[model samples]
Every structure is written in structure tokens, then in C-alpha cells.
Target: MNQPASLPLAESLLAAPLPAGGPAWLDAARREHRAAFAAGGLPDTRIEAWKYTALRGLAQRRFADGDAAAAARGVDVAAFALPGVEGPRLVFVNGVFRADLSALEALPAGVSLQPLSQALRGDAEPLRFALSRPALVGHGREAGDAFAQINAARAADGVVLRVAAHAKSIAPVRLVFVGAAADAELAWHARNVIELGEGAELDLVEQHVSLGEQAQLATLVSDIELGDHARLRHVVVQDAAAGANLIRRSGLRLHARAQATLHVLELGGALVRHDLRAELVGDGAQFHTRGVFMPHGRQHIDTQLAIRHQALDTTSSSHWRGVAGDRARGVFRGAIVVAPGADGSDANLSNKNLLLSPAAEIDTKPELEIYADEVKAAHGATVGQLDERSLFYLRSRGIPLGEARALLTAAFCRAMLDDLPNAVLREHLSGLLIAQLPA
Candidate 1:
């Protein structure tokens, strides 16, 4: 990797003064992250990890730092909110927690929820400990990960949801992040932390959208920890503005016998990338991830997933489906690493994509690194278009060519969409997905 002589945007950000409050340790951490960003700089298309996605436009933009005190006017909650998936909502507009637009109804007992900005100002020992944990992210500390470092140094407002031991929260907690409605280009960074105690259970949902066509740069990070025997179901939906550059990364650590199920749907963005990593550190831990990414026009969407098996009898499975139409491009990279002592680990990864047009492109990379002798791991990827036989059969059955193509393409991604636990959300996503297809 070639280092640049100067980084104007990064230098401009670092020239500003740091936040006033926080403990000595946090200040030192921020300084370290800032220094790391300066040393590594922005990643270019030449890098292997970023070969498919380019950051030249993002680096050239002039963006001002986000202001938590800035009021978000004309925010319509009904537009972004789901029809029947309503309960315990937290809305953050331009990286600021909007209390007036939030609803904390039907919260279960033994659950504590608050904004991270408030906790950072007061005594937030738990948050500090969790953030400082070594196993929070598998490989985010590397110098080349500039976005992770920047987020660590500048994150201000986010959610902090913690469940007590042996408790269960049946209602899903929705975290909605809205971008700027104004035309000014703004840079917002936020970090959310979620912790579940032993024998605890909960459902979490996150949605990202924008109100205007502003060229906003939003960086969001999530840190999740599950105690022994804990269970969690996580879902994410990204449909930001047409000109937004969004980078959302999430890392989780699973303890003994812990289980996690994650579902992601990416439908809209100009340049969007998501990095999701999970570490199975204890015996009998299980991690499963599924996603669907569809990009059309001149849009670009990338999904990177890495799972590490560090203990015996651990298991992980990842399945992703993508569809690229028009002149759009899509990428999926999934990696599973089995440690030396992680014998009896089972891992499976599969990625299948469809190219709806001659101009569209899809790139799939599935890899498995196994150092253990007694592990079972398999990885595979496929990039192709709709089956001609199936299309012909549908057309022969009195269906038009366009309708048949759309039906087969939708069915190709239905396996992952059907696994979504929520009926209303699934139905809503199904409708939205079909509407985006080439009609």
C-alpha cells in the first residue's frame, strides 16, 4: 500500500479541538485513533480489501463535523417507520438523539436503555469497559481500517441497551438513523453498544434513511456482547439518500452456549459498505448471518463478513444473495477462520448472485482458513444470471417475458428473505424489493 504525501480532509478534521469531557483513558484512546488515521490515511482501489470499491469521491468531499445540538426540522417519523413493527423506538437525526421524536413504550422489565452521549458525560463505567474490551472487534485495530479509527475518535450520540440476567424482552427495539435534509454536506459518526447478561434474550432492529439528496457521509459502528446462554436476533435495513456515502460496521463476541441470528437487507445508496464481524470465543457458541443486497443504476453496495471460531464445538453459517441491474455493481466477501485449538468447529459459507443486465456486475469471494485438523468447513460462490430453462417454462405458461424474469429473480432471493422472523417487516421488504426489480 502506497502512503499519500498529504490527506487534506483528514488533516482538516484533526485540526479541530477534541471534545471537552470524558475521562483520561478516553482522551488517550481518541488521540491514539486520530494518530492511527493520520498514519494509515484513506484506502485506495489498489488495496486488495478495497479493490472493488473506490473512496475517491468520499475523500474529495468537503464535510463539516456533525453538531449534536443542531435541530432536525421537518422530520417525518411516519415515512420511515414500519406499519406493524412498532415498539420502543429511538430516533437519531444527523447523529443527534431526538427525544421529542422517540417513543419508549412497552419496554420489558430489568432492561436499561439510554443514549450513549448522556452516558459519556456522566459515570459510564460499563460503556468504558465494553469499549476497551480486546475482543469487541476481530480485526478493526489495524492501521488500514481508517473508518473504524475515525469513528472511534469522533463518535458522539448513539444508543446503549443492556438487559439484566435471566430476563427476556419480547418487544423489538428499533434504532432509526436519519441523514440531513439540508443540502450541506455533513460528516456524522456514531457508536452503539449492546450487552445481554446471562440467560437473557432480546430483539434489535436498525434502520438507516435520509430525507434529502444531500451528499452526507455517515459512519456508524455497533459493539455487541452476549453472555453465557444468551440469545439475540439482529436485523438491519439500509436505504439512505441517493447521494449518501454510508459505512456501517458491527462486531460481536459470543460467550459459551450463546446464539446469534443476524439478517441484513441493503436496497439503496450511492456508495454503501457494511463490515460485520463475529468472534465465537466460547465452546458451543453459534453464529448465523444472512443478507440480501440489490443495487441498480450507478449505485454501489458492498458487504464484508468475517467470523472467527476460537473455541471447541463452535459453529457459524453465512448465506448471502445479491442482484445487480442496470450499470450498478455489487460485492460480497465472506471469510471464516478456525483457530488451531478450535477443533470440532463447523463452518459453512455460500454466496449466490444474479446479473440482470449485460452492463451490471457482481463480485463474490468466499474463503475459509482452517488451522484445526478436526474442523468441518466449506465455502463456495456463484455469479450468474437467471436460468434460461425456468424463464422459458414460465413464458410458455402464458407469462410475459418481463414478468417471468422478475418472478424468477425474486424467487432466487426468497430463501433468505423468508428466514426473516417478522411477518410485517418481511412483507414490507418483499414489496419494496419487487418494486426495485427490472419491470
Candidate 2:
């Protein structure tokens, strides 16, 4: 396959040189993936996985390589502080690790956390399985998408976290990625590898923020593994600049009796997309996710989720909400599959969206495929507006029309965050959600 002539983004990225000097196996893997990306370029809307979100504008643009002054970038550390989270922290500036801005003191016992660049410098043997993987699993036909391939080829620094067997982290680990305004449009790639040993437990918070408005592109890929009897709680908050474009993909695998839960908020960025995939490879495994995406102005946000139940008695559930105002657009897709011989499996998904303006648009699709007998599966999606009677009632009570509309909109999105355990973080997130609404 020849690289598409319309895709200047891919041509510019592939022209940049990879980091020099690594183990023979790692180098070979990078070369192979780079060649693959050079051949395939980017996927278009004709592909089933990209039917809703188009990349024509992105394909016409060109971006520089990594940021050269990432280490010297001036950032206000106090701006990103959360109320209740005070654990070990790792901060990346334009995809490069910044030791001066990180807080790594008093790390909990049995937990090993470090930057991927540092780990690769020493004994990288432990990370071979994740780094050497050919393609992202569970993505079906889009497993070899261009973004993931380029990330595998060009990524050099990211989060590398591991927990020992039976160890429990008292405080949540925070990973922060800050995008600062650069001299020119640039592109950066990151790869994260996280694993929890048998009987381990952990809570993680991932954040993406921006310092100022800059036209840049960012791609990230994360691989997560949970062993038998392990548990994980993950949260993500994304608030990038309006001129930024962000793409991310995450793959998770669960063993026997393992459990994982996730909460996500997508609020900023000119163009943003997330692909989340999970597999239950052992019996009694469970996965749950709750999320909300609000796009105002001309922003575009898309979320794709896929789950597979490959073992007996596995369970999965998802609930998500979307709010689009102005001329913005929102897209959501939820897919669940029950493999053969996987009896007693249960799965359900629901997505509800609200459109606030005549010019705004929302696209949603819910899919389910069951190949096993005695399995329960269900999925649904809806798009509509706020109730007129509720708005009228609020106006009759002396509240201004604008305030009433904001009140109802806030309530609609707040339901997804009601069950969050952390009071401080929950309130903060709620405030952010309200701030993003049209006033």
C-alpha cells in the first residue's frame, strides 16, 4: 500500500527521525512499525471504525517533531493542583518528562513508578511484552490504525507503573501532561504501560491540560493489565486548548475475579477522540465505565468503547452522556461482544445526549454481538433536548431564563458523577462541567 498523497500529516511525521540507540529488539520493533505506518497512512471515514469522525482537515496540515524546549518551558505548577490528591506525581511537558516539576518523594511500599525513558535506559527486559506487541487488540479492523502505529514507533517517554502482589496504594497516583504553546505547530507521541500483580489494588488519575492556545497534535497509547483478584479505579480529565488536536487509545485485560472501573470527562480541544477497549479473559471478571463529553463552540469530541466477554460469568456495564451547544459536534459508539462458550455473561450499555442549539449535532450508535447461549446483552442510545416544562417551571419561580437553562443542563450531566467516592474531586469536576456550558 502506498502512502496517500492527500495525507501531508503522515508524510511530515514519517520524515522525522526516531530517537537513536536502543536495544536491538526495540530498534527492530520501531523500524517495523514505522514502515507499517508509512504504508497505511491514516484511516478515512470509509472504514467502519471511523465512519462518524472525518480527518480531512487534519490530513491537510503539517506538524513539526517533538518540542525542543520542553524542559525549559515555564508552567504554573499551582494551577493544576487538585484539592484531595497529594501522592507521588509525574508531569510531562509536551510529551517530555520534567523531573523538576514532579514530586516522587515518599513513594508507597511495593509500588514501582518511573518514566518510560528511565526504565528503557536500564533493564528494559521487563517491558518487552508490552512494547513488542504487534498491534492493539480488540479494535477489530482498525487495530492497525496510523496513530497507534506511529506512537509505537516514535514514543520515547511516558508513565511506567507497577504494583507488587497484594500491595495496596493508599493515595492515588497522578499523571499530568501539559501542552504549552510552542514556536510552531508540533506533534508528540506517548506510550504508557501499567500492570497490577495478583491481589493488588490501586487508584490512578490521568490529566491533560494546556498552558495556552497552540495548534499542535498529540497521540497517546496505554496498555493496562490486571492479574487475578486485582482491582483498579481510573479517572481521566481532558482540558486542552481549542486549537489542539488530541488522539488516544487504551487497551485493558483482566484475569480471574479482577475488577476495573473508570470515570472520564472530555471538555476541551478543537478535535479529540478516544478509543477504549477491554477484554475479560478469565471468569468472574467485571468492568464498568461512566463518562460525559461536553463540546461548545466549534469543537468536536468522539468516544469509542468496545468490550469483549471471553470467559464464563463475566460482566460489563457502561453509561455515558453528551452535551453539544453552539456549532459543536459530539460522537459516541458503544460495542459489546460475548464470545462463544461464554455462558452466564451479562453486558449492558446506555448513551443519552442533549443538543442545545439548532446548529449543534450529535451522533450515537450502540452495538451488541452475542455468540454464546444463555447470555444477557442490551444496548441503547438517545439524542434530544431539555424538557420545556421543566424550563418553564424554573422561569416561573423568578429565575432568569439563561440561569434556568444552565441549571437544567448542569443537572443532566451531573448524574454521571454522583457516585464518585471523592467528594473534593467530584465537586471540582462538577464545577468544571458547569463552567463549560453556554452562558
Candidate 3:
């Protein structure tokens, strides 16, 4: 697969010098990634995971590896608001660490929020344990997908959050990824790692947005591990330029008695593909997923998710909803696998999408593979227009047609936002949704 010539620029720019001076082991791993990414530039439909999203459009574009850092000047954090909650916030501008822009004051006991550049010098064991795990991208030694390979080789700064044993954070920890490089050709490779110690509790919010018209490419990876009895709530929102391209992957590991709830919200972006994967490695582990997306115009969004139950007594639940209008395209593919020894595993997955325009498109796939007959697993998917009955009911009340349509769409996403468990945060995100919705 010949990458569009514009990509080599990104390759060269991201391949630049490393902050830690590049360790031998890390460089070797990156070399492997480079080989893998080179082997598979843009996957075709034959690949099961990327069947719907033919990467042809992106492959043809002279995707810019941007160099517009100076243009990122004069950013107003006030103008980029999510509406509801107040808590400790860390801000990143154009993938560069902006510690000065962060509002981090007091951290809970047993919690350390250090940048990767800093962590590399402190501890080796935790870093190895987190990076040694299998990637959700690799299909085999050739590494399943080239995207992960490319990101691993070029990624720059990232946040390393460690929650020590028996610790808890009451307020949500928010990380804001803001992209506004005026140079207009910057490429950002962002990586984040989170480690939860035994019996820890945490709430996290990951936000992404671009402030300018720069042609940018963002590849992000989040690696996370949960210790025994740990609990985590994570929410992610991706909003960027209408021409921005993003490839993001998140991998998770759960130990016994650990639990997690994840919310994915895709409100904006020209092209967005998110790969979310999780594994339950301990008995009594639980996973929950809820997602919402409202795409309009020429926007394109795809979400691929999977949960693996390798231990007994694991439970998983997922529900996702989306609305596509104008020429927008949306997709959701979800899978649940129960291994042989994963007895007593219970899993349920459902995906629902609405095509608001005749030209808009949505493709959804939900799969369940249970090797253990004793395990219970089910999956379902639906793609349809607005409910006729509901629309009629709303119209009969003398409400305007456009307002009624927006109301119905909001109702669908409301359930997911309500799952946040934090009243302040949920309400805050809800307002953001309301602002994004068409009035």
C-alpha cells in the first residue's frame, strides 16, 4: 500500500528526537512498529474490522504532517468549555505539555500524575508491565494492524497516572487535548497510560479539540491497567477540525474484583476512527460501555470495540447510539469473546444508530463469541431513521418539526450521559451536548 506522499513528512517529523534520548529497548520496539506500519499502510475491506470504513479516501489525501505550532498562540480555554463540572484539569496544546495551563492543585493520596517523560526516569517495572502487554492492533507477529505500529514509533509526550493501593478520587480527573497549531501541517502522536492500584477508585474525562483550520493528523493510544477491587469511570470526547484525521486506540486490563465504566462521545471531527478494547483478567471483574455520537455535514466516524473475558464471573454490558445527518457517515462494531475457562461470564452488547438524512450512512456490527457454553453472551444492532411514532407524537403537540427532531435525537443520547454517575459532570456534559445539537 503506497502511502500518500504527504505521509512521509509526518513520518519524518514524528520520528524526530525523543525527550528521554530514546532508550535501546524502546527504540527497538519502535523499529518493530515501523516495520508493521510500513507493511500495512491502509487496510482494505477484506480486513474484518475495517470492512465498512474503506480507508481509500484518507489514503488518497496528501495528509499533512503539520508544523504550525506558532499558530497555536492565543488559545482561550474559556472559549473551549464542556459546560458542567469543576475539578482538576490538565491541558495539552498541540500535543505539547502545557503544565502552565493546567489547574492541578491537590491530588488524592496514592495518586501520581506524572508525564511519561518524567516517569521513564523514576520506575522501570510499572512501565514494562504496561507496555509489554499485547496490543489491540496486532493480528500476529506482523502485528495485526499497521496503525498501532506507526503510532508506537512516532508518539511523543503523554500522561502517566498511577493510583496507589486503597486510594480514591472523588472529583473527576480531566485531561483536555487542545490542538491549534497555526503552522497548519503539524502531526501529533499522543499516548497516555493509567495504572490503578488495588482497591482504587477514579473518574476520568478525556477531551480532544482543535482550534484552527490546520490540516492535522492525531494518533493516540491509551494503555490502562486496573488492580484488584479497583473501580474506574472514563469518558472520552473527540472534537476537532472538519478536516482533521484521528486514529485512536485504547487497551485495558482488569484484575480480579476490578470494575470499569466507559463513555465515548464523538461530537465533531472530519474523520474519526476509535478502537477500544478491554480484557477481564480476573474473576469478579466487570466492564460497562456507553457511547453517543451526533455527526453532521461531511463528518465520518467509526468505532470498534471488544471485550475479552479470560476469567470466571466476569460481566460486561454495552449500549451505543449515534445520529448521522447531511452526508455524514457513522459506524459501530462491537464484539465480546468468552474464553474456555471464563465460565459464569455474562455479556450483553447493543448498538443503535439513526440516519437523519437520505444521503447519510451508518453501518453497525455487533458480535459475540463464547467458547464457554456455560457463559451467557448476546449482541444486537439496529440502523434506522427517526421513530415515526415518536416524531408524530411530538409534532402533534404543536412543536416545530426541526425542534422536534433535535429533541428526539437528544433523548437517545441522554441515557448514555446519565450513566456518568457524577451529577455535576453529567450535567456539564449534557449541556455540551445541547450546545452541539442543532437547534
Candidate 4:
């Protein structure tokens, strides 16, 4: 079959030369994944996993490989800093690591943090198992998507973090990805690997921001593993430029007695999609997540979440909220599955959405599949506008109609930030949520 003309991005990427000078195995793996992507091309809406998000627009756009001047890009360091988050930080501009802008001098004794490119330079053997995995296999079938294949083949730099056994970090580690304006449209790929040893505890924050309005294509693939009794608190804030298109996939695995909690805020981008999949592979494992996505103007945001219970007595819970205004659109899918023989598993998911304009749209889907005995699973979703009575009451108190609407919308979205442990950070996030509403 001839490659379609709509897929110029894939064709252009396939024609570019691969990265030079790596281990023979690394080179071979990149070639194999690139071949797989070339054979499959970009997936269409016909695929069940991609029904709500279409790539035809993205496919028609062509992008340069990366920003060669990323290191020289003048970015104000103070712009992307967060309150009460003064710790080890890794900064990347246009998917390239910047040593001068990054702060990695005084990392904790047991914590090892560095960019993937640096780790690959010396003793690349330690990362072989992760970097060499087939892109289209395992992990709830979400990891096998076309974007994952692209990242596996083209990603040259990202974050590599490790925490030793029984060690706890008092401060949170931050990973910042900043998109800067380039002379031409660009495409970048990044791969992140994070592991926590047994009995270790850590807090991680990941942020995506842009220096200015620039049309760019970016793909990120992250693999996280939590050992027995390890605990992780993960937070993500996505506030890219309105012209940027960002796609990301994250896979997490929890072992015995491991607990992982996630808080995410999606508030920017022209077109954005996130695929998050988690596996509870050990007894007594727990996973909890809360997120909010607000797409205003003409932006489109989609989030796909899947959780699988593969062990006895595992528990999982998810709560997500969405608000779309103007002509924007939002999509959310939460799916949970319990394998046979995984008894005593409990899973729950709830998704609520609000439409702020007649032209706005929100799609919410909640699915549950249970083959195990003694399992308790529940899922629900709702799409509607704000209550008229609440708005009326506020307006009667002398508040203008627009102010009342903004107040109600802010309150609706701030519910997702109530449980954040850091007071300063939580307040900052709440302020950002309120700022995102139309005034």
C-alpha cells in the first residue's frame, strides 16, 4: 500500500537520518522501532483507542527534527519556578537538556537524577532493559500506539531518576520542559524512566510550559516502577502555548504494598492528548488519581486512563473533572479491569464535566470489566452545565452575571486540588485554575 499524502509528518521523519554513534544494540532497536512506525504510519479515528482524538490535522503538518539552538535559547529561569519547590531541578528547552539552566549540584545522597542523554553516554548497559523494549507490546495495549513508537525510535534526551532503597527525600524534585519559539516548526521526542526502590518515598513534580506562542509537535513516553512498600506522590501541570500540540503516554507498575497517588492539571495547548495506564501487580497495592482539564477557546484536550488489577486485595480510585468553554472540546475515558482470580479487588471511577458555552462539547466515558470473584467495581460519568440556582443566588448578592459564572466555574474546578499536601503549591495551583476561567 502506498503511504497516504496526509501523513507528511511520518514520511518526513522516516526520510531523516537516524542518530549516529551508539551501542550496536541501541542502534538496532531504534531501527526496528522506526521500521514498525513506518509500516503502521499514524493511527486513524477508526481505532477504538483513538476514536475521540483525530490525527489528520497533525499528520498534514511537517516539522524539523529538533532545535539545534536550544542551549542558546534565552529563557527566564524565574518564569517557570514554583512556590516551595526549591530542590533539584532538570530543565529542557525544545526537548534538549540545558546544563546551565538546570540545578543538579546538591542532590540527596540516595537520589540519582540526570538526563537520559548523559546516562546513555557512559555505562549505557544499565538502561538497556528499559530503552530496548518493543514499543507496541504490553501495558494495557496503550503503550503500543504510534506516538510511543515514534518516541522509542527518535527520543534522544529525557529524565532518568532513581531513589535507593529505604531512602526518603524531604524536598520535591522538579522536571521542567519549556518550549521556545524557533525559526521553523519543530518536532521533538523524549523518554523518561523513573524507579523507586523498596521502602523509598519521594515527591515528583512535572511541568510543561512555553516561552511564547509557537506551533510545535512533542511526544513523551514515561515508564515508572515502584518497588515493594514504596510510595510516590506525582503531580503534573500542563500549560503549553496555545499553538503547541503535545502527546504523552505514561505507564506505571506497583508491587506489593506500594502506594501511588497522582494529581494533574491540564489547562493549555491547541491539541493535547494523554494516555495514562497503571497496573496493580502485587497484593495490597493502591492507586489513586485526581485531575482537572479545562479547554477554552478552540483548544482540544483528551485524557485516557486505564487501570488493571492483577493481584488480590488491590484498590484503585479515580476522580476527574472537565470544563470546556467557547468552541473548545474535551474528552475523558476511564477504564478499569480486574483479571480472573484477582479476588477482593476494589475499583471506583467518577468523571464530571461542565459545558460553559452552547458551542462547547465534552465527552466522558467510564468503563469497567471484572472477571474476578469478590470484586467491587463502580464507574459513573456526568456532562452538564452549572446549576442555574447557584448562579442566580450569587447574582442576587450584587455580583455581575459574568463574575458569578467565573466564580462558579473556578469553584467547580478547584475541587480536584483540595487534597494536595503542600499548602503553598496547592494554593498556587488553585490560583492558576481560577485564572484559567473566562472573566
TM-score against truth, every candidate: 0.95, 0.97, 0.91, 0.97
Task: Give per-residue lDDT, candidate 2, residue 168.
Answer: 92
Ranking by TM-score: 2, 4, 1, 3
- Candidates 1 and 2 compared: the better one by lDDT is 2
lDDT of 4 by residue, 1-439 (tens): 2234337888877776777666888889899888778767786776676777777788888999989999999999986989968899999999999998899976887999999999888888878988888756333334237788878889999999999998887889999999999999999889999999999899999999999879999999999999999999999999999999999999999999999999999999999999999999999899999999999999999999999999999999999999999999999989999988789999999999999999999988899999999999999999999999999999999999999998988888889889999999999999989999987
Every candidate's lDDT: 0.83, 0.90, 0.77, 0.90
Candidate 3 per-residue C-alpha lDDT over 312-425 given as tens digits, one digit per residue, 9 for 90 to 100: 999999999988888899988898999989999999998888888899999888888888867888889999888989999999999889999889887887888775776766
lDDT, model 2, position 41: 72
Give candidate 4 misplaced runs (Cα > 4 Å). 1-6, 137-144
lDDT of model 4 at position 268: 94
**Which ten-residue region of model 3 has the weakest summed lDDT?**
135-144
Q: Which portions of model 1 show Cα errors greater than 4 Å?
A: 2-5, 67-69, 132-144
What order do candidates take by lDDT, descending?
A: 2, 4, 1, 3
Question: In model 3, which runs have C-alpha deviations exceeding 4 angstroms?
Answer: 1-20, 62-72, 121-125, 132-144
lDDT of 3 at 200: 96
**Model 2 error, position 225 (Å):** 0.3
